[model samples]
Target: MIDRSQLQTVLESDFLERSFPVFNSPGIKDEDVMIHSLGCSVWNTLGHELGFMAVVEGPAPIASGNDIRSDSVWFDKADNTPLVLIEFERYDGTDRGYGKLEEKLGNLMEASMRWGDQPTLLVLSAWSPGLVSAPDFERLELMFRRGFSNSKGAKIPAPTNCQLLLHRLVLSESHTGLLQLQRMNFRWS
Candidate 1:
């Protein structure tokens, strides 16, 4: 089981305070640069929150039958055991579309399969204000409940022990200098 309160505490801390400034810096208009910078910020914040000493791009082929690559993987600071697998999806305000959301769901399913029965967290972090709406989130949640399938009808069952956390980062102009992080309650069972 996930310690929701602990995770909430970590998120509510000064993590965003230290992370979002990277975007406010000059010359961050490039989409790739913004994505990479946000990934790094998230990696650092997860390390601090989870006591992870190493956060690498991936432990590729996290499962035996598949070749999916996780965006980042966390390791324990002391023993170096895998702790979490993170997948990041960023949407520029212009492209608030469902295609990206479907792609992200596929990635999450792959990560969940790789995680198996481990206590590791599978984080699906989306940095888009448009993706944070209730209907959009519900649609994503439904995908998780239904599992993944190919166009030809082959199906992959969702992992039983894969605890998922959907972290949605909404950048609002109303909050002049703040990036709001909303944790959507997505049930895996």
Candidate 2:
């Protein structure tokens, strides 16, 4: 089971305030900022706040293709067993965002095979206020439960050892600053 209190402490910490200033820095594209930088910041924060080693853009092989990429992977520094596999997106409530979620879920399923019986955290980090709305968040949760099918038209089993966390970055009105960091609980049954 996940320690909700510890998770809450990490989410409520100064990590976002300290790390998100990069988004406001001049010249970076707003659309690409989260994709390019947020993952690293979150990886570092999780390491500092929880003592886990987090790696960005880690390489992993997927069943469907050659080695696919992950936004970040978190694990114990000593043993190196994966504790989490994170995927980031800049969802604007569009079809593309939904498609991205589906693709990432598929990759996560393949990645979980390496962990054996240990549970791995499947985190989807994205923009907030957009996902804050109840209906939109619920829709994403539904898609998570109904994972993608394989080329054989057979449904791939969702990982029972996986726990999903939706980490939303709530930005300021200027769209260049972080207002808040929201952590919403999502799980696959």
Candidate 3:
């Protein structure tokens, strides 16, 4: 069973590390080709590393039977269960990022309700390089934790391993196509 910590590591090494300035690069103007190809490549790399099958814009694994396409979904090698569902949101502005984040949370929450009891990692990977400050991540985490109600009735009770990872991109002159991650990992109850 893969724990949240292990999931964090894989997300960092396999996905985040591979998808850099290209993924979250503020420098790039034309992103037509890079967005299409790199998105699939990073997830493919992640799926290969963890022995899972990854797809971009694939249908979500919610039991609701509604057609919901997630940013990324990872299935078990046997091609049965979806072990992970990720939603990527670009941190555009102060007011905009929150709405996008909340929308992404809804996607994860639906999947969490369906598969949170099992070993699943519902991730909201946001790209906020210099837009969002460091301390605001705490506020973001608390805001997200509220999405999962402690009592299970209206709001789905998040799994013990429910985590929100906010990616802060930091550019370094040494690496040409790189922006390092300053991550704030929060475990929601």
Candidate 4:
């Protein structure tokens, strides 16, 4: 099973590259573009170490066998199985707009539900301009928990293994450094 720290350490270098443009200035960013960029970065940084090839906006595994898409998926090179699944979103403000996030979480839930038993990471990365407040973070966690349990016949999440990783990416505070990347901790609770 892949540990949270391992994934966290790999993505630490990506925080700046991923969060800068959106946080530095006032303009809208494209979620698809960000997902593609993340795919390149993840594969370049972790492909060899994990033997997984990252794909962007690829077909997801679902019971219905429909053409559902996932923002990012890392496939096991040896077995061609999806080992990491992610859904990315860029919310307008720190507060509100959780409905969009909930939809993304639902997407992640669907992809994870069909994945075979293995060491997998179901990720939801929601980028915000500024840091999310305590109440907002609480709501995010609650939404994930609710959705996770409702998926029937899904892999039971274990703290050390398969779990929904909810990440909040926000701009760094002035003291930390102007327009820098800041991230919050995540794992199924």
Report the lDDT tens digits of candidate 4 across residue range 44-123: 44544555677767676546544557777777777787777777676655345676776676666666665653436777
What is the lDDT of every predicted structure here? Answer: 0.58, 0.59, 0.55, 0.58
Backbone collisions counted per model: 0, 0, 0, 0
lDDT per residue for candidate 2 within 13-49, as digits (tens), equals: 6655566544344313445464447656665566556
RMSD of candidate 4 to the truth, in angstroms, is 5.7
TM-score of each: 0.69, 0.72, 0.63, 0.64
In terms of lDDT, the poorest run of 10 residues in model 3 is 167-176
Count backbone clashes in candidate 1: 0
Best by lDDT: 2
| Pairs with backbone N, CA or C atoms under 3 Å apart (clashes), candidate 2 | none
Q: Local error of candidate 3 at 109, Å? A: 0.7
For 12-34, candidate 1 gives per-residue lDDT tens digits of 66665565644433313433455
Q: What is residue 25's positional error in candidate 4, in angstroms?
A: 12
- Which predicted model would earn the best TM-score? 2
Give candidate 1's error at residue 164 in angstroms: 1.9
Q: List the pairs of residues colliding in candidate 4.
A: none
Predictions ranked by TM-score, top down? Answer: 2, 1, 4, 3
Better of 1 and 3 by TM-score: 1
